[model samples]
Target: MERDIIEELGSLALATRLKNLSERLAKDVSQIYKESELDFEPRWFTLVYALKEGEELAVTELSSMLKQTHPAINQVANVLVANKLVNERKDEADQRKRLLRLSTKGEKLVSHMSDLWGQIKKANDELLDESGGILLESLDKVEEALDNKSMYERIRSFQA
Candidate 1:
């Protein structure tokens, strides 16, 4: 058996470990989506869901809503538009600002995935419960702490 460097490094490798775990989990769900012939990327789920709920949003608005970068959201939006999963239009009030809305295909895809999404949520809830339900609480606390003192600032201070 191989030694786990992340486990050995503990807090020193927290970010790397977290990223690895996130990727692993995402890949698992992506596999499921692919197996079901969803023709969607796992990364698109949040954006799709946001559009489904809000009906439409500008790229900047989506970036804020998803806590992601404008460029990142725009990139995904481009792909979504190309795939016909989303429609892009100039904002009526602001011609310079583009907005995104789900296409008919996107809606039908979402409707089809609703049941699978529920199952995924249930599995996540069960996993959290099995782990004493601290995962989400701990994540919330971490986010709050990070908001109070950003990781970038912390690293900069340490470097200085």
Candidate 2:
């Protein structure tokens, strides 16, 4: 059997390991969506779902809502616009601000995927539950601790 670098590094490689896990999971979900004949990417779901639930939202508002950087949201928005799944319009009250909303195509897709989305959510929840919810609880704790003092600052503090 080959040695696992991530397992060997343990807590010292927490960030790297978490990133690896996240990327793998995202790939799995993306494959499922592709296999289902859905023209969607897993990374786009967060913004898409937010737009589906809300009437419309400004770029900054979406950035805040999704807890993503403005540039990040804009990058996804660009792709969504190209795919004809979302539309960008100038906010009436603030011409400088642009609002985003799902296009008709987006609405139809969401409606079609509703059942699949439910199944995906349930499956994910079951997996977490099977882990006794420790994965989520521990992640929450880690996020809270990092929010108090960033990882960069913590590391620098330990340096000689």
Candidate 3:
């Protein structure tokens, strides 16, 4: 079956390209993270980005939004609070519930980081264009497939 054989080869080629692209993306992210002055892990940037949309969020809400375990999110939130990047306050309606909000300093830092990221993205787009449309098209397909799958399902498929 020549058609079946061709499809198998195509799948293998796609898989190899995906792996290479993932490696490059990881390196790029590491480089970007190194540019930040904060002594925090790269994941902290996700939290910062999440808070960029609004001021206050309950700890549980943030945990859900970030798709992180409650304890893990709590630990990150605590570190942010200690660094004065985020403030914790008791909810007015329910004093027992704690709300987390970005501090003014945090907002400024996020804004600056956003600008830097935008520049990096523009540079990356230029480079991708120079490399031809193959990589960009492949990444777009991967993103669409990911959007159609659950996060865990996508991760499991990658692991396999």
Q: How many backbone clashes does every candidate have?
A: 0, 0, 0
Ranking by lDDT: 1, 2, 3
* Residue-level lDDT for 26 in candidate 1: 91
lDDT values, one for every candidate: 0.91, 0.90, 0.76
Each candidate's TM vs. the true structure? 0.93, 0.91, 0.56
Candidate 3 lDDT over residue span 1-160, tens digit each: 3466545778657667667766786677777667665344555766777788666898788888876888888888888999998988998999977798899988877776777768768877887888894877876777677668955796698899
> Which of 1 and 2 is ahead in lDDT?
1
Looking at candidate 3, what is the lDDT of residue 1?
36
Model 1 pairs in collision? none
lDDT of 1 at 132: 98
Best by lDDT: 1
| Model 1 stretches astray by more than 4 angstroms | none
Stretches of candidate 2 above 4 Å error? 92-95
Better candidate by lDDT, 2 or 3: 2
Q: Report residue 53 deviation for candidate 1 (angstroms).
A: 3.4
